[model samples]
Target: MNNLLDSFSNFSYRNKNFIFLSFLILPLLWLGIVYLGSLLIFLGHSFFHLDGFTGQIVYEFSFKTLIELFSSPANIDILIRTVALAACVTIGSAIIGFPIAYYMAKFTSPKVKIFLFIAIMLPLWSSYLVRVYSWKLILAKEGIINWFFEKLNLEWLLDTILSTPVIGGPSLSISYIGMFLVFTYIWLPFMILPIQASLERVPNSLINASHDLGANKRQTFYKIILPLALPGIIAGSIFTFSLTLGDYIIPYIIGTSKFFIGQAVYTHQGTAGNIPLAAAFSLVPIVVMVVYIYIAKRMGAFNAL
Candidate 1:
């Protein structure tokens, strides 16, 4: 063992380039075979058609599925609903996470910062299903929100809100607002950590210089702090948006029977057994994310990433 270790060490030192290339090859091979290969297969399946009556997939290439997906009003509506909901979640996560992240990065002591950072990430330790179900319970008709409102004699207010159209429903658990709340809560850590990292990198000297140059707190935030933090915000948005786009579970748990892109894909592939249509539908999010990342890179978010 000793002699083998010595020989391997000598080889590593003698052929550093080969060693590094060897080290990279395994992961690259795994990525190509497992990830990209599967992706290519999935994409290839989209070009095939499924027979509705026979319920069998026809392997021959066709564009009918793609056309149907793009032209269908119901599918278009689902796409729009998902895009809008994801945008809301992204915006909401950014708004709630930024101040907390800013405080952790700029104001807290090292110990306090560590504690806060742990607290921010603590939710992730729990099972995702557990978190989603917890929100389901919390937003149910007889759940804590209703219980609290009852205690405060504000049940009537909630009743009124739930009776209104668009954002309202019979219960908070099945409303758009509830889904938004749950999504923001689930993805908050992703936003906070990135923003905190970006904030920490902004030197105290720059902040002091800004103040010395007659910039007030608000001006410093607007001109210096915000501009520097933009990249992190964009990074966080990418995670929150893409996750929301591809998520069906959260919407299924905390929302009404409305169909999002993920849910639609699941239904088409699993229940309806239309693999081609499902694959075509699934491409929407991937294409959207590609465009989104491209735009983010153009806006200089890649620097922070």
Candidate 2:
């Protein structure tokens, strides 16, 4: 037994690749068999058809579900709405997070940086549902926001926002604007962390060199900082965009009757028992992320990570 153990240790020491593969084999199997296997099975359901009369799923493969997914006006609307919201959330996160990230990276001392990092990450330590529901209350018609507006005589401004077409509803909590706000808030940390990381990697010497060469602050930023940070921004966008695309809970709890892709999937699978339709809805975001990642890759976004 002792000889066998010695021989095994010697073999492991000699073939580091074997040690690496031994450690990796279980995780790779888990990923391949459990994760990818389940995903393939779920996606395969999209090819099958559901019977309307008997409420049974036909095991045979067909394009009927895919056709229905694209052809239906309502489904198309949901898809469009989801895509638009994701885009809006991504843009909003970028806009709001960049300044904070820039300040954290370039201006703050180590102690202040730690404080800011904690502030950014503190919300994530709470339950996701709790955070979302808290937003629901904060944005409600009779919430503190409304009271504050009334106190300041700015109720008209709030009313005007709530009265706007398409994006507006009877209350802020039930409006697209509110949903957008929540999405942006939830994903802002993701955006900030990446941009901050990228910006930290920017050499101070480069900035000094640019100044020495007679480049102004604006010129230096536009030419050097922004270009280098583009990858981080894109990486962050991937998180914010993909997350908004698939989030059902926020839309369901906070927004109007309009369906996003996630809500549609939940309804089709859970309530309606139309598994194929749900699977098809699931594929939309996957396809969208594939395209998005492809574009991000083309722009060298992975370099920042």
Candidate 3:
């Protein structure tokens, strides 16, 4: 082992480019064969159609599946619903995470910071399904929330909110509001970490400089802090938005029967056995994320990464 290490070090010193290329080859091959190759195959599947009579996938090239993907009203609604929900989740995560992140970055002692960071991350150590189902119990009609409200003689407030339109439904567990809350809770950590990292990168001198220049707290935050932290905010939003867009489980477990893009893709592929439609449905998030990333890049989000 010592001889092998010495030989490798000598070889690396003598032939740096060769070693670099050698290291690059495996990953490049893996990307080509595994990632890009599979992506190409999946995208190709979207152009094919399913035979109505025999229920077999037709291998020939056709645009019928793609056309139907865009033209179908129900599919369009699902797409819109997914984007809307993802946007809401992203905003909510940002709102809830930013303050905690700011405090950790700016005010907390090292020991307190470590403790708070651990607390933020501890929830993620448990199974995602466990956390989700816990929310399920919490949001149920006879669950802790209702019980708390009942003890306070405010059960009518819960009932009233659940009866409201759009976000509300017959029960909290089956409502859009419940799903949004779960999404916000689940993705909040992703938001906080990035924002904290970004804020930490910001020098205290810059903030002090801003204050010295006669900027108020609001002005300093708006003009100095936010602009610098934009990249991290955008990065966190990318995670939250894309994750929410592709999540079927949270909607299914915590919310109503209304279909999301992820649920539609699962149903089409697993239940309906319609591979082409499933592939096409899966493309929505990919396309959306491509555009989203492009926009984020234009806004300088990639600079932080």
Candidate 4:
């Protein structure tokens, strides 16, 4: 027993190459078991067909589900709309986030920096559902905006928007604005922090040199700061894009319970009870993201942003 204990004690446990590799191996194993294993299970189920007559999976491989997924016009419409919405929201967030992050990096004092950071984070801790619900009330026809208009006797403002085909619509109940607003709110922090890290890495002397060389604010921002922070921006883009693609709950609560890939997967696994088909559909977005990441990396995403 003493010999065994002595042998055990001889094993040095600091993070040497072997120790690091061992740590890495444990996580790799966990990932394989949890993620890849789940995917495989889902894929395996996809081969079995759901027999309508029997109300259970038939032990048969069929292209019926895949064909239906591809051939359906409604599914195609949803995919197109989801893609467009995600793209638009991503652009909006990038435009909005860039200015905020740039200002915070270049202008803010250290004394107020932490406070500003906390202010950005404060909403994240609040209920997502409540945020959506708040928008619901705000966007309603006779809600706060209309109430304000009535109080001011500006009745014309109400008619113009409500009468407009798609500009303002009847209410905010299930508008694209709701999705865009919430998506921007939730993902803004993601965009801010990454860009801030990149901005910090840029040597202060570089910016000072540009100023010393008589470069104006626009020239410094576009030629110096933007290029240096490209990597962070790209990283932020990936986070925002992927999160928007996979989110079901946001649309479910705020929008029209619209069926994006995440909702489709959720429905398949839970309500539709077609785990296999859901798994296959889940890969569509994963594959899309992987390609996007690869393309983004090829554009020097690693070191730029």
TM-score for each candidate, following the candidate numbering: 0.92, 0.95, 0.91, 0.81
Q: What is candidate 2's TM-score against the reference? A: 0.95
Cand. 3 TM to true fold? 0.91
The model with the greatest lDDT is 2
The best candidate in terms of TM-score: 2
The Cα local distance difference test for each model comes to 0.91, 0.93, 0.91, 0.75
Global Cα RMSD, each model: 2.2, 1.6, 2.4, 3.4
Which window of 10 residues has the lowest lDDT sum in candidate 3? Answer: 296-305
For model 4 the local lDDT of residue 59 reads: 66
Looking at candidate 2, what is the lDDT of residue 1?
100
Q: After superposition, how far is residue 93 of candidate 1 from its true place, in Å?
A: 0.6
Candidate 4: 10-residue stretch with minimal lDDT = 7-16
lDDT of 1 by residue, 17-40 (tens): 989998999999999999999988
The residue-by-residue lDDT of candidate 3 on 71-129, one tens digit each, is: 98999999999999999999999999999989999999999999999999988566789
Error of 4 at 252 (Å): 1.5
- After superposing candidate 1 on the true structure, give the runs of residues whose Cα lies further than 4 Å from its correct spot: 1-12, 17-26
Give the runs in model 3 whose Cα sits over 4 Å from its true position: 1-13, 21-31
